[model samples]
Target: MATQREKDAADYLQKHQIMELFDNLTSMLFFYRPDNPREFLVEQLKQLKLSKQTGVNQQNLFNNSNLDAVIRILDPANQSYITYAQYKHALTTLGIKDINESPEGVHEDKISHETFKSEAIEGLQRCSSTYIKSDV
Candidate 1:
């Protein structure tokens, strides 16, 4: 049986249309086999041409700082690499409130592959929706 938290996470992902994004990303990763998912994400953001459409600087969205942070978070084990699960977890936790500080006493900002993917997925969905709704 799924835990209440798991169910809630699923609900959140479904509510925000993040599942679609996750599925698409998963498919792309399976086919592309990028050496570094974090780098791949940066590349995707650049290819999105979001800055051109919204008049915001692309550097703000796909910079070395952000990529480094993501890489660190996604590979909490310090294994110098990440698996698909780690990638998904990092993406899912992107916008979840207090997820790093749940009543269960989870640590905030401590990157772990065990982190739920729905959390980060929510963040990605929010970004996607925001771009879609922008005047671009």
Candidate 2:
């Protein structure tokens, strides 16, 4: 029922995963609540483009602040750790698929702040690389 132009637009967006990009951008904007959201988004997009072009881990979205915020969100009680299940869920939400039973620095069912930060960084970097390669 869509016009040709509309269909083409939808196809283009799907091909480039624009919606997914927007979803991530919006999520970060809300979580970080930067005073200059326009600037923040611009910087994130620039980093993504750079990463895609050079295959470098230059994206600022996976910085320590954002990762720390993610950990805090997952650990609402400030228990200094999240369960393995919680960590997996967090990774899944970030579009990271592959998960090991136990990554370095993480033990048992508890994912401490340092462990979560380290694991999340690696997972996010992998996801970013995969996304860049596939989308290109």
Candidate 3:
């Protein structure tokens, strides 16, 4: 049986979206592999604070730079594209769950970086709005 304190801690984490925040932080850290992770984290946290203060919905927490990094990581051969499956996996990793198909005119078998970015941006916005709706 779980203790009350443990249950409360879990509730707190979920309520504050701490786990999702940590997941994004860890993913970005690994993707960048920066020389100074602490400094990187500080910048990211500052952005997060600014966004929150501005009432910006950033639940999915993805940016153009991160999207580009994801494409590069998935397309290790410098092909400038990734398989549809890889694109889907990348979206899932970025906490984007609402996008089931590529953006219009994108080939499923060979998704270009631009197409992926479009779909990712759409999905991120949708997911962030969903969070806002749920919270209200």
Clashing pairs in 3: none
TM-score of each: 0.29, 0.54, 0.56
Winner by lDDT: 2
Candidate 1 regions exceeding 4 Å error are 1-7, 45-136
Which has the better lDDT: candidate 1, or candidate 3?
A: 3
In candidate 2, list every pair of residues with a backbone clash: none
TM-score of 2: 0.54
Which stretches of model 3 miss by more than 4 angstroms?
57-90, 93-95, 100-117, 125-136
Candidate number achieving the greatest TM-score relative to the actual structure: 3
Model 3 lowest lDDT segment of ten: 127-136
Sorting all predicted structures by lDDT, with the top scorer first, yields 2, 3, 1
lDDT by residue (tens digit), candidate 3, 1-136: 9999999999987787776667667877887898999999888776677566666764455688978787878997979778888888888887787776745444548887888898889877765442332232
Q: Candidate 1 residues 36-113, lDDT tens each?
A: 987886675554357547654332223345556777766656765455445545544543333333421143433333
The runs of at least 3 residues in candidate 2 whose Cα sits more than 4 Å from the true structure, single-residue gaps closed, are: 1-55, 104-107, 130-136
Single out the weakest 10-residue window by summed lDDT for candidate 2.
Answer: 127-136
